[model samples]
Target: MSSDDPPYLMALPDPVGAGKQKFQLCMSELLQLVRVHLPGRMAGAGPSEREQRIALRKALGYLDSDYLIDLPEPFFGALLRAAVYDPDPSFNRQFVEPLRVAFGARRTQEALLEVLRTGTNQERAGAARAWYWATLEMVEDIQVRWDQAALREFVVNEDIDVRRCLLPQLPLHPSHYPGELHPLVAEAVHIGRTHPDEYLRHRVELQVRTGI
Candidate 1:
C-alpha cells in the first residue's frame, strides 16, 4: 500500500495505546468532571464568545493540573494529539487554544504541519480538525502554507476519515491554488465527485457552489 493509505486499508494493527485509551475515557467524562471541578466557570445561557473562551481556558487549566498530568506520549504527545483527535470540534479547542496561547501561533502551526506531513492517518485527520482553531488571527502566509499542505494530503490520502476531516477545511476554488498546484485542486474535486462518503460529496459540492 502507498504511504497515504490508512491503517485499516493496509490491515495494520490498531495504533491506539494505553494513553490514548485513557484520554478517550477522560474526554467521555470531561463535561461532568469540568462541572465538578470548575463549577460556575461554564457560562450560563447565551454567553458571549469571549465568555465561553474564558470558561474553556479555566476548565483546561483544571484538566492539565489534575487529570492529564501523568498522561504519556504516543497518545498525549503533550496534548497535541489529544486536542486534534477530540471528536467534538468545540471541545477540541480546550487543547488547541491553550497550545497556541502557550507556544505562540507560529510554533503551534509548525507542529501541526509536521503532523500533517509525517504522522499517521489518524494524526493527519486530527491535525486538520484542529487546524482552524489553531490558526485564529494567524498571518495569511502561514494559512496559505497550511492550505497547500492539506490540499496535497487530500489528493493522495484514500482514508475516508482523513478526507472527511479535510474536506471542509480545504480551499475548493481553483483560484486558491498556485499554478503548479492547481492540479491538486482538480484531483480533490475528482475525489469529491467519486468518493463514496456522502459527507465528502456534500461538502465538496457546497464548497464548489459557493466558490470558497
Candidate 2:
C-alpha cells in the first residue's frame, strides 16, 4: 500500500480481519437495539431473527430504502453513533451519508465535532474518517472550528489510530492557529512527522512541502 493509504489497507491480515470482525459485531448489536427500540422496523426482514440479522447485515444495518430520513429521532441518533463509532472507516459512510441527507451538512459536521471532542479514542478516530464526508461544502467558520478541534485532539491523543486518522484533516500550517496556539500546531506537525505510521509521516511531509 502507498504511504498515503490507511494502515488497514495493507495486505496484513490481523488488522483487517480484526476490524471486519469488530464491524460485524457492531452491526449485530445495532440491529438488536433497533429491533427493541423500533419494533416492526425489521418486520420486512422476515419473522426469524436469524433471517433479520442476515438481512440487516446485507443491507449495511439500514432497515429500509428511505436512506434513514424517515427514521425517528432516537433511532437516527443511534445510527449516527454507530456510524461514527464503526471500526471500518470505509463502511461508515453507509450510516453517515443517510444522516447527512436527513439532517443537513452543518448539523452533521457539528455532530462529528462533538464526537471528536468527547468520544473514546476509537470513536474519535471514526469521526475523523467520517469528517471527510460530513464536510460536503466549504464553510470557513466550520472548517476552522473543526481544524482546531482536530489539532487539539491530535496533540493530546496518544492513540496511533487517532493520530493517523486526524493527520490528514489537520491544518499543519502554523498560520491556521492564533499566535499563542501556533506552538500547538508545530507540536502536532512534529508528532506527525516522527510518528511510526508511515501514512501519518508522509501526510505531514506532503502538507509541509505543499504548504497545504
Candidate 3:
C-alpha cells in the first residue's frame, strides 16, 4: 500500500476478511444471518417454513439503527437479496442510510476503486452504485479523478448491475464527463432502455424523457 492510502486500505490478513476489523465483523454477522434465515428446503407450507419465517424476522430485528451505521462489504449483497426475498420496506429504509454513510466516508474513493478493480461481480456492482451515491451526496468532496475512473470502467462493464449504476448518473451530470464521453453514455442509455428489467428501463426512459 502507498503511504497516501488510508490505514484501513492496507492489505490485512485474509482470514480477517475485507475492510478493517469492524467491517469484517459486520460481514461475518451478515453472512450468518443469511445462512440462518434461508428458507427451509421444502417448497410447500410446513413447520420448516414457519421456522424459517421466524428466523428471518429475528435477522431483520438484528439490523437495528446502530447496526446500519457502517455496514459490511457483504451488506450490499444482503440488501439486494433482502429486497427480493424479504421485500420489506423496513429493509430499504435500513439499507440505504448505511450505504450513504460508507460512500461519504473519507477513504471511500480508494476503497471503492479497489472493489471496482478486484472485488467479486456483486461487490463491483455495489461499488458502482456507491459512486452514484457519492455524486449525489458527496459532490463537493469528490474529485474529477473518481468521475473519470467511473467513465472508463463502467461504460463497458460486463456486469449488468454495474452498468445500471452509472447509466442514469451520466445523463444527469453530463458536465462531469467530457464531450468525448457522450457517445459512450448514449450507448449505455440505449442499453438501459432495452434492458429486460422493468425498473432499469423505466429509469433510462425517465432520464431520456426529461432530457437531463
Pick the TM-score winner: 2
Pairs clashing within candidate 1: none
Candidate order, TM-score descending: 2, 1, 3
Clashing residue pairs for model 3 = none
Q: How close is candidate 3 to the true structure, as a TM-score?
A: 0.47
Candidate 2's TM-score reads 0.72
Would you list the C-alpha lDDT of every candidate in the order shown? 0.67, 0.69, 0.48
- Model 3 sits at a Cα RMSD from the real structure of 14.4
Higher lDDT: candidate 1 or 3?
A: 1
List ranges where model 3 is wrong by over 4 Å: 1-26, 29-104, 131-143, 172-175
Predicted structure with the largest lDDT when compared to the true one: 2
Locate the minimum summed-lDDT window of 10 residues in model 2: 9-18
Q: Please provide, for model 3 over 1-212, each residue's C-alpha lDDT reduced to its tens digit, 9 standing for 90 to 100.
A: 35454333111112212223433343344446556443341222223534544443444434344534444566555543332222222332333444445334434455556666766655555555555433344544454555666666565675555555545454434555788876766666666777786656767666656564
TM-score list, all predictions: 0.68, 0.72, 0.47
